[model samples]
Target: MTFDVPDASYYGALITNDSFEILVRKNANTGEGLFLRWPHDSDTRPDLLVQSCLDKEFGVNAQLIEGYDAIVFIKGGSLVNFIVHYLGGDIEAVGLQWVTLKTAWELVFKLEDHEVLLSDSASLGVLDRWIRNRRRKIAEESFDGEQKKWLEKFDRLCDRVRYVLGRDSACYGGDGLYSEYIKSIISSAISTMKEQEDLDLYLNDLFGRTSKPGRSAAREADLIQAIHVSLALSSLDLYNAEYTNHVKECRRVLGFLVALENIYGSSSLEIRRRAIEGGNGRWRGHDKAGRIKSDQIKVGQVKSIESAILKVLEDKKLYRKSDRVDVIAGKIAGAVQGEISTLGLGDFFVDKDLQLFIWHFISENKVARGLIK
Candidate 1:
């Protein structure tokens, strides 16, 4: 049997006036399938794509924010093309309702295999990208207005560091020279931040990320880039924490710390010194007076467990224990159990180790200085 699949399709993200909601639809004919998209065909003119979708779906015009590349999908032995548009405004559309991203994701993605409404690539792609973009937009909104221009300049410095090191700015913690270089940069930045009483003034400089050519100057060049990279990351961490009221932390800085902790273990004196000190406002209020409370345990022991705890502490600075300790332990045990089936050290450790580590971490970090005295 010979059959042809449709050649072209179009979809868009229609954001609400407040930008907190997106227009979505449920097709009653298709078992009430949830869709965060509008339908399009190849015949539509490129110039009128957004307007056409607006006319068909809501009969109201809205601002077009951006257009993404055409995403091609293969279904039923045929190629179907889709163009994604990011739109914003308020509109009343038939068979559609404006829903928060959380509600939309739960309905579209959190479904049984048979109940999946976003089975098509177009819907899934549009929904995924829209959510990600929206979150970033929100994060950016948290930035201080006065620091906005300075923030862009800091971003360029970070970009230059990534370029010179031949590392992707979007990636973190790999097993290579570049990764080591990144670590060094972050370590240096943290170390420098500790001594500066006025963190803002210290960071308000244009430093170099590239080293001068020649073997003699290579070390100096490396040092300079390290400073810039660390400054960029540190800036992000401090600004995000301050502006977002600690509701958010810079993802890159958090990722780097996780990776660094995984490799060095959380208890490593070297790692602790680099991560915990330096007046980085992000690490402020941490109980640095006491040492690691686990006398029975030492650095390099049960690192996977520590890494799990680190994940839970994403909302906090170094050494602080999250309230979700039980949940954290359960997740760690589950991970170790899954790994046990495939040559993991499940027998070498037990749940007690995780419990003990958590206790040690909390005792050292959570206990007040007055109590320690």
Candidate 2:
């Protein structure tokens, strides 16, 4: 089905590049609509909406818009997909974005105005919260489902390759080494992984350091893990805790060897094996494939980031209002900004917007429920 009501949407140019920008008109919905913001109708096709929005916002003789990318960022719905899907064959997505569950909740409460789209105010109360929560949960679960399928495939590969004779595939997760390895990486592999006692022990071991992991550290961790998993899938090194951990963290790696096998068949595995053996001591072959989606912060850049981050944290309190909180947010934002800049994506947002983007990202992606040793 399609949207059944008329709602306002802001339209802008989405440049896809090393440094991309969504050329949005500031105050897009204000009166005397000088900007490219207009109506979205439930039953209308995107081309029609695009044409109408342009005609209404600009003038009778506004030039025909062509050869540009379209970006449809909606509140909490999959309307982006519908628009992208129905926008016809010519349209292409310039980029992808994900928001944290915290940001999702904030948006729902702060900005989601349902009156224009939904007549029932009843649906806007608890129902609205449920809708958003469920949407997020469903997405997470769907990813888990895919992981489960891959996991099963992975277990069988071990059954065939490792020759754990007559061992039930279902029990691979229970193996001591497997559990130790997977739990270290998969995160959600064991639901009730640890309690508070275990976490305190782990934290105490670190001497109560509150400093968050830097983006550079995270990037390096991500890179090493990627290569580790590729090597594991290629059967180069499975006993190493690194590859064992990685094979279970398929989502964070944005699809994995299983996906490749699905598309290219078992030949992909053989190719990967060849790549691994050829690389020898040096990084090469399948091990070198894929990347961390975010830009990496290098060791030399750390000094520069430290001062820059501390400055932001110390000075500003427009909303959160606490130096401590600001510092925390600043660290998160600064790390995010570093990732963006390194990836050549700084043009998408200013400093403040980038901070908010990071806040949302951290919340939506990871949720640590209990402590772990």
Candidate 3:
């Protein structure tokens, strides 16, 4: 029952890494003619096709992680399956440039014309799926190089605070210790303000007096909590909070953490915002705009998803030929919204796509598939 379109189909490779970067070969510098040119042979299985494309394109070995018919192109109504691959650090191949996912998306949207060999859906869907599924992982790894180095510096400062506090354990061993402990530290700073200028400034900052007013309370809470956490890390024998360079170091650390907090929204909100505001303005795993196609859940495979979808159809008696297709699809989509949102598919799946997919699946039993026209 293959349609009379081009006998050619396409297979694409989506190379990604732990650092949230993707490997892609740009068409000149415009990134138009993307996706590896895959030879279609009926005898060739998907895994073999992926491996062949990888070997031919990158001249490197690839371990196939996952594969899916991620999109259907309208040009020839061809279904494109993108194979997701995780490249090892040992890659020495030339031509393939590694770019961050954000850069990759930017390149994708900049295309004014689609390539004959490359389907826009294949490119967009694969990238979108990866981003939605790995948003948190991406954010966590975003702090790898310079950010990690700075964070480690902050950690060392907190460690110093812990060591100083550990020197005086006897006084802080009783109940209501923090109240007395912090007060004693403050009293020491005030009484010796002239002798320990750094300690006095640190104490003033610690007590929230030095900070500018009307800052975000949530962020301020995070800074205060971090200080409390450092203090809580260890309790030793110390007469008072010291006036060493650790004071300035601690202040610097707090400022860095607060800056990170503001940008990342505790490292979660910014990612969510980007996911929503990025390409299509929908957060796939959390929003209703995401889609799930028939290929995403093949018949009789992925029973959890299949059964869930079918149950919705059955509950509304939408399986009957007499039922209206639009009503049936809408009901099914709404009913399975919760399940679909958790399936890690990107937000590209809309109600119209779900309706079409339903009609594609059950039209034989109810109405003719041609009726979709």
Candidate 4:
């Protein structure tokens, strides 16, 4: 099923269970006319056509249609059956419907008059504020619940792994002994801080201490735990006290592990003599240099983590802003600039019209991403 579309033009195909629509537009920058309608409709609505496609399915294929003309496709009748038979499923159909909905929504909202009305209306101010606050609360509660669940699962894993390491002499013998010994030490430390009150005090003390390099590591652990708890609470909104308690307990365990790691290096020299003389004496002189090196690698892999975290925070801020759409558009503009720079196009022509064109494309894409929610 295929149809021929012109070159150097943008085409959007919206296929549904019963009907299909195809729209074709000239250069998105030149304010050219658009042709749109159901394939069978001879009298189509030219005014309803959009300058750019806003569907996620279509936006994802932006590069494919960027400067191309002509699209060939067959819609209706056995076309869908052919699609299902050829593709082996209806996932693409679902995705296409999602894009169609988004495209329709964008067409309604992107009107110049609607933009003016939104900008000039005083009542919209109060409505926007109320919506923002409501959304923030919902996001926070959702996050809390998710955080609690994740923390409980993480704690259970830590406990099980620690127990296995403690009992399995065969697996932890030789060079893996140091990791096992550190695990034991951490497990013991965690046992000592059984209560949340004790754990909180320990974390606060570690946060205040500055004399030891170990304190820096401990402080980082505490900060990371706090951030994790905050994000989880904000994101998950877990109402179960058991889950929250388990998360707190997991934080305690992580703090203990960080402290133990700080005390024990990768060498046998770092292990206490008493530990070597214990029943696990056969595992003495085991090295953990590789484990330490791996941890170093993880710590060094910061760029992607930082970028993702910052993006999340920026998105949250945008959502919280009074003018979320505008703020997001600004972010998208900045993102486009950064992307262009990465492509070595920073020195290219700095045309306002071209920049605006790119910004529109990015903003439409962002809106499409949001609609997936």
Candidate 5:
């Protein structure tokens, strides 16, 4: 189905409130572009990252050539660091300059930053702005009273489109771009704009389908339109995948807690439950039985966690090992690092969360993968 983007020219003017700085990696290997971060962590190749918004994130209807910046968020840090790290030790921090959502969105239309890489059609903003400005000047100088009134009505419709897209003044395209190709739903008639959740679902469904583009694929312009649609749709998919993975982590944590409670004899079931729900405060101290119960959960022999886990492998007959826990500990630590992105408790992730994540990691990576006995 064709999504008629209401006042497509107006979307160029849409702004976003929250913005941040990011590192835009430049990949020297592919000679293609920077190595952008993927939304989901992979179980297969936990190291190899994938996905790109610049190529296909504006939805299947509005694919435009844009650049991507590696945006990393670390806990308890004020600034989300942005750096372009070349493997050969050439690292550019991008000056840690704040880029607005509008500035980021401007990538779709135009990227003003001189140091940033420019796509072949990077001047979309400039070209479109010139067109809009010319049209506006014509309307002001040559239009009749009725024609002027129509321009005013168009402006109002554009405002409505801006609101529907959840854009603030800070986003981008304060100027206008006349998009002749994409159809937009009219402003007043639009009862409701498609929610982000709906956008996410649509993208997921679209990704799995191999059907042709909604528009004709024959024409150059039409083919270009398909690219935009593909990007926007894929971007939504990437955005949704992250949240879905986070929820999956939450569930994994819950299952791990339940299993540990059963195996370890319930040291702090309440804390486990709280962490599962949402981390509010610290969960520490001890139980009435004088057991160690706190924010962290350990599942090993009283003296060595490494020894305890290594025994599991030995018991399963996966590997014959001596009493040396450090051997397996090194490998286990690498696996754990892949699962728990950050240390300590995060917004929805607790240490117990990591505990469960490690459980599922082993279950899938080892047991399910059939790598071990």
Candidate 6:
């Protein structure tokens, strides 16, 4: 059945401090009377009553009254029509309560830095009163099962949201994206528990239906949410570590690239001279040294060498070991020295193999993939 809200302001104006008698007009044939009484005081006006009713209905504390008088009034009404007419329609009354509860839940969870005001002692009392009132109504023969189910759903949603945002911890490990979704499910379960407890007392009182005293689906969900949250956090930590290592690797590569460029840009004679000096008193040959030190290569020479080294280092299959730079550099140096022998500067380039090996090692070890972009 639909309900129509009364004009609270108009009715409030009718109540006066003088306590003057208000008339009750009875329809003799219908045996119905319209009873009217003035508000007790300025503070006890119809607006105050409406506000109190709203607060109690939503399981929130109202500063209007000292206790749960508003809830008492609503639950005290006859089964045919609740006293909601004094305030408004059933839809408005229920809507207002739902809004208030939702608002309170948001406030509780949103303020991560602050304690939940809804859990305050004063607020808990109000919530208790609301729960008791609902229980009483549910126990009555006039109670609607559908309405109860709706209320239960609302409560469950609010509770779940609250738990998810309120608690700090982890529950499991998995991919970052999947972890968050699982965490949400866990939060849903936790919230369900809170809602179920509130409903349990009423259920027991009305239908003698007792809830099993242990963790169930709801608890399992909470656990899963925690696991997911934990997994996400852990994944973030691992990602950051990998990123740091990449940067270091990049820097090392950059250093090696600079060295290779410098070496390749120099004339063959200059390279031969450096190699001879590096060998320290070793025999040097003009043709071999010139071949080893040839600077006739283009930019592509350096690029090709660097690219090959990077590719080798990055390939997990090529470098099974975690240390990538050393292996790539060693292999490149050996290959370059072998190529130099055919260039016919083998005599001038003293200790060509050793020089090439050292150059490759220095370049390979200079930067790491972990340090690079």
lDDT of 5 by residue, 131-177 (tens): 34544675468656654554454344333222222121122333221
State every prediction's TM-score relative to the real structure: 0.33, 0.23, 0.35, 0.21, 0.19, 0.18
**Candidate 6 Cα misplacement greater than 4 A, ranges:** 1-103, 108-121, 132-373
Against the hidden true structure, what lDDT does model 5 obtain? 0.28
What is the per-residue lDDT of model 4 for residues 119-201, given as tens digits with 9 covering 90 to 100? 21111222223333443455347546566456455534443333322322222211111122333444444454564567667
lDDT of 1 at 214: 29
Point out where model 1 deviates above 4 Å: 1-17, 26-33, 36-43, 46-50, 70-93, 111-373
Candidate 4 residue runs with Cα over 4 Å from true position: 1-89, 93-218, 230-238, 241-373
Candidate 3 clashes: the total is 13
Clashing pairs in 1: 193-279, 194-278, 194-279
For residue 296, give model 2's deviation from the true position in Å. 20
Q: After superposition, how far is residue 348 of candidate 6 from its true place, in Å?
A: 73
Query: Number of clashing pairs, model 1?
Result: 3
Give every collision pair in model 2. 3-42, 100-360, 100-364, 101-364
- Number of clashing pairs per prediction, in order: 3, 4, 13, 30, 33, 36
Candidate 5 error regions (>4 Å): 1-124, 138-142, 166-183, 186-373
| Candidate 2 TM-score, true structure as reference | 0.23
Per residue, candidate 2 scores C-alpha lDDT tens digits across 135-254 of: 434434644555544444454443322111111111112221222223233333122224335854643433222122322323333333442343243332232323445454433233
lDDT of 3 by residue, 344-367 (tens): 542435434533344334432222
* lDDT values, one for every candidate: 0.40, 0.30, 0.44, 0.31, 0.28, 0.31
Q: What is the lDDT of residue 174 in candidate 1?
A: 22
Candidate with top lDDT is 3
Error of 4 at 8 (Å): 19
Q: Could you tell which candidate, 2 or 5, scores higher by TM-score?
A: 2
- lDDT (0-100) at residue 64 of candidate 2? 26
Candidate 5, residue 213: lDDT: 29
